[model samples]
Target: MPVVLSLNIAQRTVPVDYAQEGATGIDKRPVDGPLDVRAPGPKGTAGSGVAGDAIADIVHHGGEHQAVYAYAREDLDWWQAELGTDLRNGQFGENLTTSGIDQTHARIGERWRVGTALLEVTAPRIPCRTFAGFLGRTGWVKRFTQVARPGAYFRVREPGTIASSDEITVVHRPEHDVTVELFFRAVLTEPALLPRLLEAGDSVPPEIIDLVHRRTTVQLDS
Candidate 1:
């Protein structure tokens, strides 16, 4: 059993100062330290256009892994084991933090119970220009995209109030070839990753799948 270092839940508004309309510019700014958990999204609330769990868009807050998140608490703690990190807020640049279990072996279509909310792991966050800002370097986005460690997103199966440090349990797991890690890796390196994600997107977060489809389209057009 892994321990959840910390738990954080916030509201996501929209029209954030840096997060824009399109997929290309969603991630911006580096969030630092922790803010009140009562606010929407991480740190503070955003605009109206982008609100919810699937979109924990971060901008200039933390330093290590800005805008990182986990839909299921099990995966959140599990990933801490795999990453060998304490799941610290400022350390990992994680805007939204969780504790419970690991997510290294989790996949899409998987179901998890966290507190009163039941959710399914949807898709991985694909790094972009905004990610580079966290590193304060150029091309780091490409490097991170290459490693494919983007965390998981869960769709609310049963909606309820979710508090910090709640217990998470797995209800179902998918029989897919790709792990969450592989999905992130494949999405960035292999064009084939798109087709698989597209099919599974039905169960994934629409925003994330939309990103996969958008990137695939960009690749095709290019």
Candidate 2:
């Protein structure tokens, strides 16, 4: 069974000297015990965020579709090798650092029973300038995009508390061709593949669906 190896949250946003926003909530720290997860509002809009987590940019971060970000320990290990550095849990700004699961391969709309909260996989986290600044890596945005192992975001279906070490069980998986890996690649690399995202129906994150629709509209007009 997959388990939550670390539960993390940040109370205050960290200063990102290079970003125009000046601060970022990407610096998350590990925490003990349980944390509440819930839908604070409409699906596409920002939720209150994890009980103790502070999301700096509401325009781009937060939202019901991205209520919680998750990354696998395995992926982090891979990055560690590439960067030649040690990465602590939550270093990637994920609310949950999970073990024994391939998060990138999780199908869009997949549901997981995490602690007492039920979460549905919605979309993939897209790296940005703030993320690059946080890492202080040169050309980090391009590097991350090319790596294309963007972690998955999930929406809270059943509001409840989740703690470190909680077992994660896949309760449901929709019959869809869109996996998190494919979704990331489509959104960032292959605009033509955007139409393929429609197969997930309403399960695809609304924001991404809108993007694909917009791209399709542009193609038709052109």
TM-score of 2: 0.95
Q: Candidate 1: TM-score?
A: 0.58
Candidate 1 lDDT by residue in tens digits, 9-78: 3333334333343222232222332322212233223321112323443342211112234533444355
- Tens-place lDDT per residue, model 2, 59-104, is 7778777889999999999999999999999999999999998888
State in Å the error of residue 83, model 1.
13
Give the clashing residue pairs of candidate 2, or none: 46-63
- Misplaced by over 4 Å in model 2 are 42-48
List lDDT for all candidates, in order. Answer: 0.49, 0.86
TM-score of each: 0.58, 0.95
